[model samples]
Each structure stands twice: as C-alpha cells, then as structure tokens.
Target: MQIRVADKAIDLSEGATCASVLAEGLSKKQFKNTVAAKCGETIFDLDRLIPAGCDELVPVFADTPEGLDVIRHSAAHIMAEAVKTLFPEAQVTIGPAIENGFYYDFAYKRPFTPEDLEAIEAEMERIVGRDHSFTCRLVSKDEALSLFKDMGEEYKLEIINDLGQDNYSLYSQGNFTDLCRGPHIPRTGMLKAVKLLSVAGAYWRGDEKNPMLQRIYGTAFANPKDLKTYLHRIEEAKKRDHRRLGTQLDLFSFSEEAGPGMVIWHPKGMLVRTILEDFERKEHLKRGYQIVQGPLILKRELWERSGHYENYRENMYFTEIDEQAYGIKPMNCLSHMLIYRSNIRSYRDLPQRYFELGMVHRHEKSGVLHGLSRVRAFTQDDAHIICRPDQLLEEITGVIQFVKDVAGLFGFDFELELSTRPEKSIGSDDDWERATTALTDALESVGLPYEINAGDGAFYGPKIDIKLRDALDRKWQCATVQCDFTLPERFDLHYIGQDGERHRPVMLHRVILGSVERFLGILIEHTGGAFPTWLAPTQVRILTVTDAQNDFAEACHKTLQGVGLRVEADTRNEKLGYKVREAQVEKIPYMLVIGDKEVADNVVNVRLRTGENLGTKTIDEVVDMIRNDCLEPFKRGGMSYSFF
Candidate 1:
C-alpha cells in the first residue's frame, strides 16, 4: 500500500501500522513526541493499521490541543488503573477529558478523601514508570458483558447493555482493561507531567435518582514546565474566586434555609446591582429603547403557543392558579411580544425595542449551581426588538455595538461566536438559514472576527454570542443577540406595510449582561473585588483619627453623600490605622481621613484604593474629583452619566 506522510510518498507492507510509517518519516525526537496520527479529521492510534485507501498521515504532537486530549484521556485510564489497584472493591465508570483536565467517577464504598488522592497519584507515577503499552482489541458485546459481569463491575455492565452495540473496543495496559473508543498514547511512560487536583461527589449519569459516585479530577501536560504554569494559574484562580471574595467583602450570601441557588443580597451588594441597573436603563433609553415590565407568571397555554411549554418546560417552574395552569417565565420574550401586539400600526413602529431588568426562574439542578454564576432565581438585562425583516441586519449590528460599548466600560476584551440551530428547534429550515446568515453578515459587515459554534443556538433561532475575557484570561458568556422569525410567526405578530398588506415582523431577543447575578459574579472576580471608582458600591469611607474628630467625620460623610457619592463614616472607637485597614479590606475606592489637623484646616486627606495619598483638599475640590472619577468610565464607553 502507498501513503503520504507530509510531502513524501512511501510504500508500506500490507500489515504496517501508522507508527511504522511515522517512524520512517519523522526524526527520533518528533516520533517520540507523536502521540497519535490524523488522517483528515479522523484520529488513529499509533498501533492501528493504516487503512487501504488512506492517503495522508499527519502527526499529532503532544503539545497540540488534540494531542493533549488524547494524553489526558489515556491519563484518565491510568488513574482508573491506579484506583482499582489501591482499592480492589472500587468499580470505575466513565471517565473523559474535559476542558483543561479530566475526571473519573468510581462507585466506591465511601467518598474518597484527600489522602486517597495522594496515594492514587503515587500509584499513577509507578504505573508510568512501568512503561506499559496501551493495546487495543475489538470484542463482541456479549463477550464484553461477560468479562465485566464476572469482575463484579455492574456499572460497566449497565453501560454495555444501554449502548446496545454489536461490538466494543477495549483498551488494556498491564492487567487493567477499560471499554473505550480510544486513540490513546502508545505507552504509559508518555504521561510524565500529571497531577491529581481534587475530589467531588457526583451522581452517576448526572441523575439524582442514581447512586452517588466519587469523582477524582486531574490534569496532564506535555512537560513539567507547562504543568507548573497551569498549576500557578489554578492557584491564582483560587485567589480570584468570587464566592470567597463575596463574603470577605460583605457583598452577598446564600443560606440553606432560603434554599440553594438563591442570592440574598446584602446592602452593599444591592447597591452595586442598583448602579448596574441604572446604567442599563440610561444606555437603553439613549439607544431608543422603552423601559417595560411584565408579570412574573403567565398562563400555561400562552407558553405552549410560544413553544416554551413544549421545548423548555423542563427548565420552567409551573403552578396552578384558579384551576388554571401557570408557568413562571424562564425568559422575558413572550411578554415583550404581547406588548408589541397590543396595538401596532405601520412600518414607523417597526423597530420598537423594549428593555427590562426582568427577574426569571429556572429549575437548575442543585449540583450545577455555583455561587451567583448558576442560580435558580436571577434577573436578566433582557430586551426584545420587534422590527421589519428589512431592518434585521441593522438591528443586529446595533446590538453588537452596544455590547462592545458596555465591554469597553468594564475594560474587557471579548470574542464573538455565531451559534447555529440545534437539533430540537421550532423554526423552519429557511428561517434558520436566514437568521444565521443575517448574524454572519452583520459580523462580517463590522469586520469583526468570529468562529462558528455548531448546534448550540436557542430553540427559537440562531444567535451571536459575545464572551468577555476578564483580567485573568477567563471567558464569561455575558451578552447575546438572537435573531428570530419563528416567535413572531407563532404569535401572528405583524406590521402594516406601504403596500397596504400585513407583513410578519422579525423578533430579536437579546441581553447585554445575560444574567445580572452571573455578571456581578464575573465582575467581582474580574476586578478582584476592587471595582472601578464609578461602579464601586461604596465610593468613599470617612475615617476619623480620634473621638475629637468624630463630628468632622460625620460632616464629611454628609457632604459626600449630599454630592451623590456613596459614602459611609467610620466613627467607631478604634485606632485610625485599624479603621483604615478595615476600609481597605472592604475594597472601598477612596478613604477620607479627618483628624485634628484636617479639622483645623477644614480639609480632608484623600487616599485612593491603590494606596496613593493625595495632599489635603477642600470639600468642594474633593467633590469635583470624585465626580470626574465617576464620569471617566462613561467617557471611555462613549456614554454619559448624571448624579441627580
């Protein structure tokens, strides 16, 4: 058989493997780093024989993304082996490579502890040192079932029965074997830089009804340097975790009594939320959007008409009211459409944008909820634009620009992704194509780069998602613009055309800050709880040096508050240094020091959150300085703000 390796053509024996061909073409170093081979899009294990019609072979290097996935997947199998060796009664279930790491679930007698993880990691190192070859073989379903059944692996038996396949592939290294469709690394020795991260409890198959299993998380890299870099990032992420900072900064809390996935906002947290809401309202109004409100729950029949009952009922909360079924909304679009249809006329009202800071509820699984990021009850900065089909592209572009402006204000760099239709959707093929084309065209028209995300769009239509990259290079999905022709058609929404005929108006469902709670959580982590001057919940804290200065501190606080600044006074009977330290820990943007000297001069000393101390300034000067600081972010975002 003849095959192509890079630019060279080589003739190989009939039973030659991919590794044999690569060994002929690549240098020793390159061949050692090659974990797998790719033929077009299909990846192949090194020991797999080259198919008759195969044309080209591309080496998948260990450092590449695809190669890393293979390495991580093989590492997971090794970890499973280590676990089974250490704990003979433990049964391993599915383990796969996730983003940045891998996890394996084991149905053990009890939850694994931190000490167990250390032992398992040590066993993994020994396995790597043994240099066991990963060999693959095909087996009939009956044979695989008998093999696992005899070994007392009930989970594997259940998986095999559920798969209902004629044959299965099994990968074995040393005495341990696992059911997998794998193109793993050639040997266990290739897994040199690996670390066990943590352990958590998970229900089998992510169903609450199933038995709980112990899941061990871990990661692997091509070399020690890369692994060290990744570990450092992990440590940094711990420091920036929003849930910890939220408590330290006294921002918010969650209580088991109030139920999980519900945020109980503290005063300071609520103040921050209010500031964000105010900014949203002003920005929307300037962009020709009308503020609106809708009822929290509506008739179930209404949801059915809008396709939510059929497609999204699982995530919705439902109840009975007056012998009628009612569903608490998971989205704000239905009511916005009703408002548009209340009374409408000509094309002049075609591009009506309705905005709301609407609160919504979703039946999120308890296991998935994390701080404010994933919550059952939260508010969305949602909007709906009812526009003529001719105005669709312009409307999408406008929303894109709006997202850009908002991201700029927060000093975020973002990326765009155009998501296409999913498997279960409401729209027709033509409508889906048109909606996707409109989003793609809008992105191209603005000369912004974007990648296509396949089959991840909303059930209603295709969308453009904007993911913000924060200070630590973590991405958050904050904004989205979805184009929909299905919802308007479903509701029979129309506008009068110049031709004296009614035409179906297209709808756009969008959110600048997708979930207010989630956005706040991201913001907390992005800024490390030290918000910018304009967005800080408490802009200034007045600190008095002694009892004699308490009255002056009160006056200073009043003056600052009178100027529309969020201010508080630290008049407690504590030392000046202690109060200053407390204020700093709270991440207050500014601190005003009032002492005997400041009182005599009728001035205040300004200390910034960055630890910069400006000399004493008069009250009027201080007010002007803060006001300018408040306007700076708006100016950068190409917007304006007012205190009154």
Candidate 2:
C-alpha cells in the first residue's frame, strides 16, 4: 500500500499501518510515540490501517485550538472509562468541550473526592499507555437499546430512546463503550498533556427538576509548553479577579444580607462613578442631546403597552402600589417615548435627541451573579433619537461616530455586531425590513466591518452591538445602537410634514457604555486598576519623606489641586520608600517626593507608574507636563497612538 503524507508519497507492504508508515520512513522516534493523525479532513487513531481509498495523512500536533479540543474531549472519555472501570455502578452520560476544557457527567451514588480525581487521572494514564484503538460504529436505536440493556447500562438505553434519529453513533475503546458523536483524536495515546481541574454536581439537563449528576472537569493541551502557559494564565486571572480587587481597593461590595446581585457602591466607588457621569453629561450636551430624567417605577400597563411585558417579563420584578401592579423600570425607553408624546409637533421639531443617565433594575439568577459584570442594579447612558424618515441615515451615522469617539477616548478597539429581528418580535414585516436595511447601509457607509448576529435583536427592532477588546485580549460589549420601528407605531408617535400631513417618525434607542457599572468593571480590569492619568481617581500623590517636609508636600498638593488636578497629600509620617510603595499599590499615575534638597531648590522628585524617573523637576514644569498630556481625553496618556 502507498500513501501521501504532507508532501510525498510512500509505499508499504501488507499489514502496515499509519503508525508503521511514519515509523519506517519519517522517524522511528516520532512515529512510535505520536498522538493522532488526520487523513484529509478526517482525524483518526494512528493505529488504524490506512483505509484503501485514503489520499493524504497529516499529523495533529495538539497545539491548535481545534486539536486541543479534540484531545480534551478524548481525555473526558478516558475519564469516563476510568470511572466505569473503578466504580462499575456508575453510568456515563453526555460529555463535551467547553471554553477552557471539558467535563463529563455521570449518575453515581457518591460524590467524587480529590482522592478519586487522582485515582481516575492515574488510571487514564495507564489506559493511554495501553494504546487501545477507539473504534466508531453506527447502530440502530433498537440495537443500541438492547446492547446497553444487556450490559446493564440503563442510562445509555434512556439516551438512545430520546435521540431524534433512528440510528446513532457509539465509540468503543477496550471494554469501555459509550454513546457519542465524535470527531475525536486518533486514540487514547493522543491525550498526552492532561489535568483534572475540578468536580461538581450538575442537573441532568441543567434543570433542577431533573436528577443530579456528578461532573468531572478536566483540560488537555497538545504540548507540554502550551499546558504550562495555560496554567500560568489561569493563575494570573485568579490573582486579578475583580471580586477580590474590588474589596482590596475599597471600591465596592455586595452584601449577603441585602442580596447577592446588588452592589453597594462605597464612597470611593461613588466618586469614580460621579466623575464618569459628569464626563458623559458634558459629552452629551456637546452632541446636541437634551438630558432628561425618568421615574424609577412605572405602572404595569405602561410595560404592557411597550411590549416589554410580553418579551421581558421573566427577567422583570413586579411590585404593588395602591392596588395597582407596577414594575421597577428595566429600561428608560418607555418614559422617553411618553415624553415625546406629551405634545404633537411639526416637521421642524423632528430628530429630537433625548439623553438620560437612567438607573434600572433587573432580576438576575442567583448562580450567575458576578462582580459588576452581572448586577441587579445599574445606570445606563441611554438615549432615544426620534427623527423623520429622511434623517435616519444621518442620525445613525452621528450615533456611530459618537460611540467611536467615546470608545477611542477610553483606549478600546471595538468590534461591531449587527443583530437583526428575532423570530418572536412585534412589527410589520416591511417596517422590520426597512429598518434593518437602513442600519446595515448606515454601517456600510461609514466603512465599518461588522458581524451579523441573526435573531439576537431586541423585540422592538434590530440593533448593532459594539464589543471592545481590552488589554488582555478579552472583549466586552459596552455600546449599542438600536433601530426601533415598533416603539413609534405602538406609541402612535407622528409629526406634521411640510404639506400639513401626518408622517411617521423613526425611533432609535441607543446607549454608549451600555451600563455605567458594567463599563466601570471593564475599565478596572482593562487597566488592572491603574487607570490612565485623566480617568484615574487620584491622578497625583505628594508624599512627605518626613514630618519636616509635610509643609512642602501640602504646598505641592494645593498647587496641583488649584490647577484642577486630582491631587492628595500623604503626610502620614511614613518612610520615603513606604510612601512610594503605597502610591504604586494604589496605582496612582504620578508621585512626587519632597525633602530638604527638593524644598531648597524649589523642585520635586517625580516618578511615573511606568518606572520612568523624571528626576527633580520644577513644580511649574511638572504641572505643565500633566496639563498637556492628560487633558485632551482622546489624546490622554497617548491612547490614540495605536487606535488608528
């Protein structure tokens, strides 16, 4: 037999296999100890004889994401095999690859312990060294049910009964046989680098009403170096966990007494939030947006009218006041629409832009509560644009530019996603079509690349979601622009045209910094709590080397504060090194040290967070440096250098 590997063809005698092909010609050391093989697009075990009609054979090295996933999934099956081997009473269910790794669920009598994980992992290594071939077979439903029934695998029988197809696939290795749909790596030996991460109990189908199954979580990599890197990254992420950082920095906290998802912003956190709101308010005013205020609670009828009751009731909180049902506002649009309808207007009043830093509350599941990321209460930088049909393009373009400028100021390169009407929605087909087309055209006109998230839009209209990538390569969706056709029709909003005839107005609901709290969370993580000079809560800290120099430090603070800098005087009698270390820990942008030499010369010792030493510069010179570099937000600390 003959076969082509990557670039050349090789001939082999009868009874030769892929493993032997590599061993004989390539390198005995590489072939006899390899993990998996890919024949064309299909991946299989190296021990499998090259099928008669096969064309090409390529090695799967386990370094790529697809290769790693296949390896991890195979490791999961290996874990299942080890479990069944150790505890014959355990029944295996579905197992699949997730974000970082994979997990397998099993119906068992006792919970798995750390000792059990160790034992299972050891067994997995032995099974891999055995190098058993993982063979796949398609069997009819009746055959699968009878086979598992005879083997006392009741769970497999149940799964076969519920499968939609009459025929299903199963994979077998040694005495271990399990139901699966696999593009699995060649064999157990391919799972070279593996680790058992953790164990937990999961509901059979993620429903509490179903039976509880113990899930074993694990991860695998193609190479040892890659595995080491992943473990280090995991450790770093844990150290930088927002929940822990929030407490250590005294920024915010969630009370177990009050609730799980509710955040109680402390004084420091509130100060940061106030600064953000002020910045947003000034930006909105400059963009021709009229700031508006709305109530915190509204009658249930209003939500019913807005179609929120039909679409979002499950995630809403209802209350009673004076024998009438009311709901805490989950959004600001209903009030904004009501404000628009307060009076009829002519075409001259078209394109009214309303802005609101509105606070909203939504009910989040207890298990999904995360620090700032998933919260029950937050404020939205919400706006509603009501414009004539002819003004839609310009209005949308302006909004997109507004979002770009804001994100650019914050040093984020954002990716855009345009989501179209969902299957369950309210509006005429023509209206939906026109509104979606207008949004796509507007984005194209601006020459922005975007992805289409089909059927993921709001109930009222289509929208474009912007996800900004942070410093660590993590993406966060912080801005959105929605084209709402249903809201205007439902609200019966209209304006009189030049011909004295009623004309329908298009409504656009948008937000920059989708929620202030969520955006703040991302900011903290993005900078690792060391904010840029302009956005930093405390821009400069003046530390006295000793009590003798307190007066000089205070003078420096006063001068900086007078010039509108966020300055603080650290006159607590701490050592110079202690003060510097404290400032670094707080992630302050700049620090100045004062002593006899510095006071006599009328100069201050300056240090930057980037480890740059701007040695003993005059106070006037230092102030001028900060003023020029930190004021223009888009240019602040040089954020725009890489954006283009």
Candidate 3:
C-alpha cells in the first residue's frame, strides 16, 4: 500500500509496523530517540501495526512538546515498575504526565521518604538498563478487573468500574502489568536522563474521603541538555520564590487567626499596593472611564437576575441580614449593571466605561490556596464598557492596545487567544456569535496571530485572554477583554438610539492587570523583589555616614521628598557601609551616601543597590537621575497615558 509521510509518498508493506518504517528510513542513532508517531492526531506506538485507514502519517519527534509528554508518561510507568519491583506488596493506582514532569500514585505501606525515592530511582535506572520492550494488549473489562482483584489492587478495580467500558487496553514491561491506554516508547533503553524529584501525599482520586496515597514526582527529556536546563530553572525559581521574598522583604503575610487566604498587608506592603492602585485609577480616567464604587453585598435576588446564583453559587459567599439573604459579590459586574440601569441612557450617553478597583470575595478551596496568587479577598483592576452595537469593535481594539501598553512597561511579551463561549454560559446563539465575531475581527484587524481556546470564556461572553510571558518564560493569564452581550439582555438594559427605538447595549468586561494582588505577586518574582524605581516602595534612601552628616542627609531627604519621590532617611550612628548594606537589603533603587567630604562639597554620592557608584552630585542631579530611571507608561503611537 501507498502511505504519505510528511508529503512524501512511499511504498509501505501491508501490516507494516512503525518499527519497520523507522529502521528502514532512518539511522540507528536517529531511531534511538524516536518514541512514537501520530496518524492523523491519533498517537500510535512504534511497535504497533499501522492502521489500515491511515493515508497520511506524521512522525512525532522526541524533542517537541507533544513528544516530551510521551517520554514523561513512559517515565511515570518506569517509576511504577521500580516501586513494584522493590516493594512487591505495593499497589500502583494512577500515574500521568503533567507540565514539565510526571508523577505516580501508589497504595503503599507508608509515605515515601527521601531514602525511598533514592532507592526507587536506582531501581528505575536498573530497569532502563535491562531494555525490556513495552507491549500492549487488549482485554475485556471482566478479565482486567479479575486480574487487578487477584493482585489486590483495589484502586485499579475502582478505576476500571468507573470507566464503564466493555474493553480496556493494558501495557506490560518485563513481569509488571498496568492498565493503560498508551502509545508509549517501544523499549526501555530509550528512557535515559530521568530523575525523581520529590514525594508528597495525595488523596486517592483527589477525594479527601478516599485513602491518601504516596505520589512520587519525576521528569524526563529528549536529551541531557534539555534536562539540565530544566533543572537549572527549578533552582532559579526557588530563589525567586515570592513567599520567601514576601516575608524577607516585609511585604505581606497570611495568618491562621484571621483566615487562610486573607492578606494582611504591612505598612510597607500597603504603600506598594497603593501605588499600583493609584496608577490604575489614573489610567482609567485618561481612557474615558468614570471611577465607580459598588456595595460589597447585594440582595440574593439581584444575583439570581445576573445568573451568578445559577452558575457561580459554589464560589460565592452568602449571608443573611434582617431575614433577607445577601451574597458577597464574587463579581463586580452585577452592581455595574445596576449603575447603567439607574437612569435612562440616550445614544449621546452611549459607550459608558465604568472602572473600579473593586474588592471581591470567593470561597476558594483551602488546598488550592497559595500566598498571594490564590486569595479569597483581592481587588481587580476591572471595568465594564457598555457601548452601542456599532462601537463594540473599537472598544475591544482599545482594550488590546491598553494591554500591550501595560505589558510593555514591565517588558512582558504576551500571546493572544480568543476564548469562545463555555458550555454552562448564559446567552442566545445569536448574541454569542455576534460577540465572538467582534473579538475575532478586532484581533484580525490588528494583524496578530492568535490561537482559539474552545469553551474557556466568561460565563456571560467570549473574551480575548492575553497570556503574558514573564522574564522566566512562564505564562500568566493577566489581561482579559471580554465581549458580554448576555448581561445587557438579561438586565434589560436599553439606550435610546437615533431611530427612536430602545436598543440593547453591548458590554465589554476587561482588566489591564487582572487581580492587583496577583499582579504584584508576579511582579515580585519576576524582578526578584527589586522593583523598578517608579513602582519601588522606596525609590531613594538617604543614608548618612555618622552623626556629623545627619543634618546634611536630612536636607537631602527633604529635597527628594519635595520632588515627589518616595524617599527616606537613615541617620543612625552607624558606619557608612552598614547603612549602605541595609539600604541594599531593602532593594532601594538609589542610595544617597552623605559623608564629611560630600557634605562639605554640597553633594551626595549615589550608590546603586547593584553596587555601582556615581561620583558626588547635587541634590537636584540625584533627584533627576532617580526620576529618569522611573517608568513612564504610555499608549501606542507616542500618546501619553495618564497615571495617578
């Protein structure tokens, strides 16, 4: 038979295996890294016979993202094999590949310690050295269940029963058998450069009621170079850990006494957050947005009307007051809708943008809560654009431009994706289609290539999610521009048009920084807590050499403060080096070191936190230098963007 391989037609024998194709067409060194192939999006093992209906075949190389996942998945099976070999009574439950690695869960005698991980890893290396071929077999559900039951694997039987399938596939290596749907690597010799990372306790199937199992985490790669690079990044990520930096820098903290996910901001942390809030306010004002405030709690009836009761009740907080139930807002849109309906709006009053740094509450799962990234109470740099149908495209375009502008200030490169309406969303087909088209057209007009994310939009509308890649190349979902037509229709929002008819206005819900708290957290890690001058809590710290220069340092501090810079003074009776070291530890942008010589010359020596020194300069020059290092955010086309 004839088969097309990447646009090249070749004569393939009947019932030919992937092993034959690679052996015949590629060198031995090349085939050593060939794990699997995909015949039209369906992955197949190299040893499996090519399906009869396959007209085209694409080889999946080990270096690609898809191929890396395959290697990791096989690595997971290898780990399970090692565990079972070492502990004959241990039953393996489930193992799967995750981002950057794989993990296997097992019903073990006890939680795995560091020594157990080392032993398992050594056994895995031995198994890989044996080079046992992985073989797959199809079996009936009854046969698989009986096999697992006889092996005393309750977890496997439960999973099999839950699947409710008549037939299942199983993979085997050496003497170990596992229930799996796999297109794994053909042989174990290909499994090289694998390492076990750590071990943790996980509830079986993520249910607390189920028995807790030991999960061993590990990772693999196509080559040693890639694995080395990944391991290096892990070390770097530890140093940049925001939780550690948050405590070390005295930024923010969480307490068991207050709550699990609530943030307790210290005085210095509050100053940092205040600057970000002020910037948000000024940006909104310049872009034709009116700053609006909404109540924290509203009647349950209002939530029902806004569809939050049906779709988002699980994540919301509710309370009762005076025999009436009230829901603490999980979203700021409901009150913003009421604002639009407060008074009659004409076409002249169209395209109203209401901006808010609204604080919202959500009942997040305790297990999933992180330091600041995942929190119960956080403020959103949120706004809603209510515009006429004709104005929807322009409004969305402006939002995209706004995101680009904001991301540029921090050197973030973003990728765009148009997220469609979700399965549980509220809206008519027509409303959804129109809203989706508006977003798509806006993206096309700007000439940006975007991927389509199916069914990942807001509950009320489709959106353009901007995933920004930080300095470490990790993507964070920051800015989102959503087209929400459902809210206007559900709320019966209307505006008097030129035709003297009541027309429904379209709503665009968007945010430039997403959650302010989350953004700050990312910022902390991205820059390693050394914030730029403009956003730094202390832009300049004036340090005097001793008591002799205290008055001069006070004068310099006053001058800097008068110039609208966030400055402070350290006039303690300490050595110059100690004060400078303290200022550096604080990550202050500029340190003005005043000494007897500098004070006599009417100048202050500028020392950077990075340890670079500038010769003595007048107070005005230092102030000018600090301001120059500050960020000046602006819109595209050289247009100045306002900030508070």
Most accurate candidate by lDDT: 1
TM-score for each model: 0.96, 0.82, 0.94
lDDT of 3 by residue, 409-448 (tens): 7778999999998999998999999999999999998898
- Best-fitting candidate, scored by TM-score: 1
Candidate 1 weakest ten by summed lDDT: 635-644
Task: Rank by TM-score, highest first.
Answer: 1, 3, 2
lDDT head-to-head 1 vs 2, winner? 1
User: What TM-score would candidate 2 get against the native?
Assistant: 0.82
Return whichever of 1 and 3 wins on lDDT: 1
Q: What is the lDDT of residue 591 in candidate 1?
A: 91
| Candidate 1 to truth, TM | 0.96
* 2 or 3, greater by TM-score: 3
Model 2 regions more than 4 Å off: 1-76, 79-94, 103-124, 130-182, 192-225, 636-644
Candidate 1: lDDT of 403?
96
Compared with the true structure, all predictions reach lDDT values of 0.92, 0.83, 0.87
